[model samples]
Target: MSDIATVVDLLTDALGADAVDVDPASLASASHDTWPVSTKWARQDEHPYPADVVARARTEQDVVAVLRVADETGIPVTPRALGSSVTGQPLPTRGGIVLDVSGLVGPHSIDEIDMTVTAPAGTNGGELEDALNAAGWTMRFSPQSLYRSSVGGWLATLATGQFSSRYGGVEDLVVGYRVVLADGEIAELTASPRAAMGPDLRRLFLGSEGTLGVITQVTYKILPLPADQRLQAFRVPDVPAGLAIMREQAAAGLRPFLLRFYDTDEARHAMADPGFDGPVLFVGTEGEPAVAAAEMGVLTEIAARHGATTLGPEPAAAWMGRRFDFSTVEKRLDTPGGFAETIEVAHTWRHIHGLYTDVKAALAPLADEVLVHFSHVYPQGTSMYLILLGQVADDAAATARLEEIWATAMRVCLDHGAELSHHHGGGLARSPYSRRSLGSAHRVLRRLKHALDPDALLNPGKLGL
Candidate 1:
């Protein structure tokens, strides 16, 4: 009577026992995503929908084989990478199958002439960079999640990182890819230097969240490793001065790779151990040593103008060391009553001050402790990554706080006419607002998924599928 039984039979026929998971834990693991912080506080224990079977896909052939059966059987299939998505994007709510591609990371190439690199989807940013370093090259995309965030996961979820101000988002680094559609058909988007060829079909897969197809290979534009690198520290009096300093640097055309402005609260907590004076700024620049040194000087002058003081680079560097960790959140939640929440929002220079004010105000009364920080920025606007944690005595209370805070923050973003999300993909959590920002574009995405994956079997329950 269960659709899962039928879907399992179909998967067994296509992928064989080696690729399919029949174990209870494996299936359950595929059911939910890293959304417990949000779901738990809301009293949601039923989420993390476990799949009937999880296909540990190793190659494109395995992916195609599994998708073929899923399509024919009308089974819901969820594509999973590193399982690093914070939202419920990878959950198989319908519980059919999960295509785990973490093992599919393969070779990468460096075209010295074109300055591009082609790597398999399962490749991780850190691993890819290490490989490039061995070959005397570099993969420039560095998110805070580089340790666990796979290149495929990066593309699948449209992730971003600390270096985004210079390298831009994952979409900016991604140029071409090889995708396996829901129909089991594989299409390899070429790594052409440029393309006027049609609608550039590649863009569809850039941030589709696995609804359109399963990404198997990722080809990106690589750059030579910058020769010089340095991170300077500064303590600003307030948020306004920090923002003004960043804007001035951008205007002066001195773009620093590690340009971050943290809210006083987060800075205080981050540097709370000992010997920390106050709010500090970590300004890192990379390039020729002389040029980098000059840029640091420029940043120092700007910070001085903004009434900022130096906090020494040692503590700032230590903070950067532990910058990447989403798994620790669940551990904290498992204890009595702890919560972790983050919101990424971007707006034009004209709107950031007011936008930040409204967002903080919205969450003021609801949060136990709200700390804001600036991780990624652009010339046009900056991303405000807000982290709110509370002690609610149980998971349900924490979940309610997270959901309520998210609702309030989303409303703030909309009120200012800002983009719905800044990287981290639209994931399931942000899907409701997709229509508001994406408009008909969301419809087009669903149509594309339907056309490519007519059975609606791929990545079910993600991006509103």
Candidate 2:
């Protein structure tokens, strides 16, 4: 039998025949992710890099069984959850086995005493959040894909949510992980109350992109649902002034669950404010009633000091109602000869302005229009999202244009001394630049990959591995 067949037989014996699928339809579906280039390829009736088999793992033991067979047979195995990653993080580049872990869900356990919630990696993020909400608790992580993404994807990609300014990213929320290594050995990296135990080993898998191991379970810190909440929008003179207001608020140790600043173009398009004439800032706070009020008051003062005009709560409220609506990009992607992409980069306050200007300028020629915003902020820096929409004449042009857009944006970010990606981990889209972006640290990553997955079979071709 061929290598693919041999691995398929082994996996079938280990996890049962029902768990393995070799149907052409399943294989085709497993080949690509939500990568924009893949959409173009699909339009041309192409299914490149189709996996030979898809193995659905219903439990941790099933994951171990799949990895064990792949390890013994040297078959490339890509772990996948909801496949919501737009950067092709879960694509089986080498056409081996697509290990489906979406079934390893729930039987979630929440420890109200410790303020943490543990769930199988495949648990849907929105479901988990809803459960927490019903219990008067929350993880405070709400990515745009909350309804579609899995917990594993969140940790795998180091994803951040709209509320990241206050609650922080997935890396900050995760307290532990249950992972299955490439060699089929299970490792539990959980410690409570912040231990100093040797470099925080759980981080090894937080953004590993499933190269080092498969995350089967996760434990995230939780918070009681806030008793009070407030949201307000302000019209700022320009991007710089808006950013200054955000920086000052963060520097003053105020944590707002919602903190976003949109450039004039993006504000006019994204917000419901029809009369938007300048850059806009959205601020939201949640906590005890008095505390939330105090924070909102400070934000208003800061905005006034920066020459911002209050637009009341309507704009902010409207945003909150549809914060997860991604139809703008989705609609474009659904149309023929059209595409939309969002690139996010970050830098300290000093370089952010220049970085934003340089990247936006470089990308303007590539896309029909470039809409910019600063959605996540920190005391020292903030993350900028560049949303661009464009149309091409054909599939070939769409493919080429997508590549050019990514290349131009990444080049400008690196040139301007900015992080290549703020929260979107290095997937296939960023793999080409991962080495240069990581620099000396790339060597360290290679060593770790070799040490854990010497054959380079786990999610091969990602993270420049």
Candidate 3:
């Protein structure tokens, strides 16, 4: 039998006939993800890189079986969960086998005493959070795709939540995880609160985007539901003014769960208040009630010093209610000639404003509407999100325009000495510029890839591997 046929039979035998699917619909769906270009391709009835077979794994052993077959046959295997990656992180580029792990979700456990929750990698992020909340706890990692994304997908992409300012990113919350290597070797990495080991190995696969191995299970640090949460909005004079307030708040070592600042255009668009002028800043704090109140007081004083006008809690409360809503992007992408995408980059406070201004200006000609926001703030730097919505002549034109939009944004970001991606890990969309973004450090990734996945059989063509 040919390689494709042989692999199909092997996977079917290993994972059972019912678990292996080669239908046209399955192949087409496995070929792409929520990437805007893929949406355009779907609109044009194109299955550009459909995998020959898709193997749905219901257990960790199923994942190992798929990897073992790929290792023996030298067929590329792309591990996927939920397929919610907007950057094509889970696309089956080499067309060998798409390892579906969305069904592996099961046997969840929460350790309230240790403040940790462990679950299968395929667990839905929102479902996990809801379960934790029921137990009087929370993960606090609320990405925009919370309801649509998977736990493994979040760790694979190094995702950050809207409340990243206080809880940190996925990297911070990961306590331990079990992964199956490209060679079918299962390895579990864990550590205490801190370790002085040779290297923090868990981080190796956290942002590897499934290019190195398949994450089968994960343990994340959880927090008790906050005692109090205070959210308030402020209107600032401009982007710079709002940024200054955010900077001061961070520099003061005040940890507020929310510190989102939207530029004038984005503030108006997001709030749906065209009449409202200038930029808007949403500040939220939680923890002990007394501590939360004190932090809010400090934040308010800093904003007032920066010439900000308090807009009460309504706007902030409204945002929290629908923070996970992605209807706007969905509506645009589903439209015949419409395309929408988001690019998030980060830099220190010094160059952040310039990066924002330059990237928006660079993307202006290609996109109809470019909205900007600074959401994930830190003491030294912050993340800038560039939301692009535009319409082209047709689906074909839309695909090309979206590509151009990404290229332009990455170019300007690189020019400003900023990281190409803040939390949305580099997938096919950002693979081409991985070298430029990583500079000489690119070689380190190549070396690691060779060491772990010498055959290059796992999620090839991503992270410039």
Candidate 4:
């Protein structure tokens, strides 16, 4: 029998027949992510990295069993949820087993006293937010993929939401989580608001992209829903002026719930009204009425200092109404030989503009249209997102162009001293550059990978592990 057939037989014997799926359709579906290159390759009817079999895990015990079986049989295991990852995080690169954990949902609880919520990792992000909102509370984690992303996926990728400027990323909100190690050992890491515990074990798993272990459950910080919310829009002279405003606001300790700066190209594409010509800045503040009003006042004053033209709240409100609409991307990709992708990178205030300019210049020649935006701002730095769209002669040409775009963009980011990724984890798309991007720190990551998963049986070929 073939190796994959033998592994499937072993898995079926260990788990139930219902848990093991070897259908060709299932394997093909389990293979790729939303990665543009992967999608383009799919257009050619090819699944280069197909999973051998899919194990539908319904509980933490099932996850343990799957991991144990994989370890015993030397099969690489890739944990998956919702399949919404655009970075190829869930792709089974080595054609082993795809551990589908979406079935392990429910049995969640909220602690109003402690202001926290706990749920299985497979729990849907949007459902959790709805539950919190019903109780007049909020997780404040609203990524574009919230409706499709799972808690475990968020933890695995260290995701950041639209309101991350105030609530911070998944790393900041995740108080604790339970993980199943490669050897099938289940471990829970928990802590209070602040801990003197050595090393912050949670950090090791956050953004690990399933290289170390499988996240089974997560506990996140929660807050009372904001009593007041405000929105405003402004048009700055150029990208640099918008960056200056964001830097000043962050440095001044203004914690706006949302701060979006779209370059001229992105503004033209994103704004409902395309009359305004310059870069557009959207500012949102939410909290107690008095506090929100005061914060809006300061934000407006800062915009005025940057020579911004007030465009009222209509544009910002419009953006909020359709923030999750990815129809444009879908429509673009549906066109023959058409492709689109987004690359996000981060740099300190001192080098952000240079990084932005260099990357934009480098990608402009490769793509038909290149749009830029700055979001997830921090006191010391911010992330820049570049959206590239183009059309080629066929799938092969599209795939090659997609690769060139990624290579060029990553090269520009590294040369300019910026991180290759901000919120999106380094999945297969960025794995090749992970070592170079992390520099000397890559050695430490390798050591951790060796210590945790010496056999490299978990989510291989990701995060340079």
Root-mean-square deviation (CA) per prediction: 2.6, 1.3, 1.0, 1.3
TM-score of each: 0.92, 0.98, 0.99, 0.98
**Span of 10 residues, lowest total lDDT, candidate 3:** 1-10
Which candidate tops lDDT? Answer: 3
Task: Write the residue-wise lDDT of candidate 4 on 1-465 in tens digits.
Answer: 238878888788778999999999898998988888888877788898999899999889999999988888888999998988888889999889999999879878899999999999999999999989999889999999999899999999989999989889998899999999999999999888877769888788999988999999999999999999999999899888999999999989999998999999899876865575779999999999999999999999998999997889998999999988877766667777888898888999999998888889899999899999998999999999989988888778888898999999988888987989998889999999999989899999999999999999899999888
lDDT agreement with native, every candidate: 0.76, 0.89, 0.90, 0.90
How far off is residue 105 in model 2, in Å? 1.0
Model 2 poorest 10 in a row by lDDT: 268-277
lDDT of 2 by residue, 1-465 (tens): 247778888988998999999998788888877778877777777987788999999999999988888877878899989988888888888888999999989689999999999999999999999999999999989899999899988988989999999889998999998999998899999777788968988788888989999999999999998999998989899999998999999899999999989999899875765576799998899999999999999989999999998888888898888988888887887788798888888899999999888888888899998999999998899999989999998767878899899999988888887898888778889999899899999999999999999999999999889
| Number of the candidate with higher lDDT, 2 or 3 | 3
Alpha-carbon deviation at 450 in model 2, angstroms: 0.7
Q: Considering lDDT, where higher is better, how would the candidates rank from best to worst?
A: 3, 4, 2, 1
- Stretches of candidate 1 off by over 4 Å are 38-45, 273-278, 325-331
